[model samples]
Target: MPARTQLSALRTFRPSKRLKVSAVALTAAGATTALALAGTATQSTSALPAIDVAKVTAGSQAGTKVEGLTQGVADKAYPAYVGKPTAAAAKNTSRDLTKAPAKAKPAAAAEHKAKPAANRSTVRKPVAVSAPKYADNLDGWIRESLAIMKAKGIPGSYSGLHRNIIRESSGNPNAVNDWDINAINGIPSKGLLQVIQPTFDTYHVAGTANHLTDPVANITAAANYAAHRYGSIDNVNSAY
Candidate 1:
């Protein structure tokens, strides 16, 4: 390998203009070119395009004779040098907001005020729950899905919907490849249980792109997919 990088080597290179002198100035630059060819050299005003300059540099920097050498740069090893590193990328400004936001919430305040034994109420909201559709494990799937739905801004409850994802991916975070009936073109399904690439792309939310592999994006996309296919995940436990 010849110093490969993510970008092409030629595109990054820029030849120094140290030799931009006229033919007359070059002759005056003189003895620097002496002890070699005696041929007179003339200058042309037309500047070669970058690609042309690169090609010429690619040739000459190899120590090939401009007049008749056939050696290409690839024939020899060229010692590589690296410039000093530029300033480090500014420190990421990401903040841990979970704690302060929780403390500031009205629900937290209400909970604190109602903690006294006399103020506690025996009445509880009727929480509707359902069984998992997929038959196996059910732990963590609903809570994760609820968090996903909120992150996506999708308004719905995991109430009767947990069964849907339980059926789709069984809570495997990076699941792909569906050997069952879902495998297409031989690659397994992927992310937050399983979602085929095309379907994910079709249902992906605006801010959540690359849903096929990104967990959050996939979760959001899966929620949207379920909502789009069935009236809700509660109806058809399709993709999840």
Candidate 2:
């Protein structure tokens, strides 16, 4: 073969290095584009909705913790999935419980507490105090004797008692007449209103001392005798 014909045949059989590299690069680029398109189609089918970057950044800056962002995102996108008035209902229940004490306080206080200040004046007061029935003195003795006498229908006076007591024993309650005719007869006249023991015993008034020498007992016995024999002690002017 001629030299030029041989050279052309070699060129046809083997390509240049630069052309080979260029061809391989073009094939690689085409394959990369096809793979990118396939990835884009997959992303479009299952991609999450876009987040508000500004809000996320602001929340991050304000140090707010993010939780359940996917669910929160859905709730924010659809208004019908929002919460109900449960918080408001709970608040109303709390308010009703707080007012329950106020409603119940009046009834409980009316049953157990003291009377109100407005009604205090209408309450009945206690009865007035009266004097005691018994006293331990001479005046007390006379008053008690008079009370008993009045009960038994025995008539006498304070002046008459004073006169008789003075005349009989000069107001000496313990005086006794041992030398008198009654004493000689074995019965002594004794006490302020002097009378023999027998006479005192015979005319002894109830609710008085049994001892004849007792002043009140003696007076009471003598008065009782006078009441029966002479109608009253006031009628006894002298020794009976």
Candidate 3:
């Protein structure tokens, strides 16, 4: 070959080989850099000193200085590390321990005293009343009927009741007029005041026995009828 041609061929082939050498060199450099970094990390890990927990605790308790630990850091780590109280703080504590509490103000005490108690009236217990007692006789029946009539606003008296009862049935509670006009109508006049069944039932007062032969019931009913028809039993002189 000629010299120029050989020189050109050598230049093109040398550039390809140079490119490969550069790539291989770059790969080796990167591998070496990675190995160096790993070795440096391992050395750094081995070189670090192990922490002695017991020594740190002893140093903190004894108030001795721990290596690389500031006083603030020591206080945060060990809460038992308390600084001495200042002179003013000690004096204030002593005063608090020895001093007596303040008394209530005189004006407040006076105002409390001036306030009056509530005006509560005492409630009295109710007095129980006993009912009136009566004898089991004609006088008793008439008297009892008068009391019931007075309460019911029926106008009659003991005298009027006695007079009518004597004329009608002669004071007999079980007296019956079976031959009278009322009896002929299928209704007999019965009891102390000789009241018929219909009249007795119609004018019957409450709180009295509902029987035709009952002395008090008979008197009260007859008196009630008389009062309605003749203004009062006292005004009726004959059968009504």
Candidate 4:
């Protein structure tokens, strides 16, 4: 062969050093991305929707990880597959009341929550009508109220039984009745219960101060009325 032909046949080719660095850099980046995706896949799936682990492991063994490489992309790829609410739900939120949610009626619900209600039947005034009241002394009217409870056949639940006595006269003999309920006859209702003339006339004896003004007698009459109507002196709660 001629010298020029021989020299042309022998060619020297050397790849640039950067090509080796580029391959190493690319391999490192791919490895890092793989590590990150692996970590994300293993993260606490406690709140996540259920995924079949056996199928994932089978796919991984079958080189499915390389096939699913791009699927691990965070916001765009993973979330696109998930179906979440496009907009927030504010219809039932408290900041806006227009939703008119089904709930307990406001007035009734508030009343129930407030604890102490205006069940006046059970409300007792803190102070005795005037003061200086001794439980043992309990006054003639209180005694009569008890007697009336006995006559009526009511149970003597002290809290309930005394509730009426407290209402009528606060367990005081000096307590007067000046209530507005009229008796229709000449005598205005007076004394502990404001008993009228007709009621007093029916129950009162001629001589004893059992007239409408007498506290003990009036209380006793009221007790009798309660006993006759409700059938128990202790049935004080029913008096109201």
Model 4 CA lDDT for position 147: 51
Q: TM-score: which candidate is best?
A: 3
Which candidate comes out best when scored by lDDT?
A: 3
lDDT of 4 by residue, 76-177 (tens): 333533332244543435366676778999999988998886676996778747633334444544654555445545344445445666676565545543
Q: Report the poorest 10 consecutive residues by lDDT, candidate 1.
A: 35-44
1 versus 4: better TM-score goes to: 1
Task: State in Å the error of residue 238, model 3.
Answer: 1.3
Per-residue C-alpha lDDT of model 2 across residues 47-97, encoded as one tens digit per residue: 444456554444444545334254445444532333323677868867656
Worst-scoring 10-residue span by lDDT in model 3: 9-18
Candidate that beats the other on lDDT, 1 or 2, i.e. the better one: 2
Each model's Cα RMSD = 40.4, 19.2, 19.9, 23.4
* lDDT for each residue of candidate 3 in 1-240, tens digit (9 for 90 to 100): 455654464344323354456545666668555334434444554443433556556666676766666445655654443354568998888765776898999999999999976666756678989879989999888888889988999998778888988999899999999998888999999999889999988999999999989999999999899988999999989988
Cα lDDT for residue 124, candidate 2: 88
Please, what are the lDDT tens digits per residue for candidate 1 over residues 110-207?
Answer: 99888866635667788989843432234444455556577666655665455655565666666666575657566567865477778787887775
Q: What lDDT score is found at residue 40 in candidate 4?
A: 38
Which residue pairs overlap in candidate 2's backbone?
none
Instruction: Pick the winner on lDDT between candidates 2 and 3.
Output: 3
Candidates in order have lDDT scores of: 0.52, 0.69, 0.77, 0.51
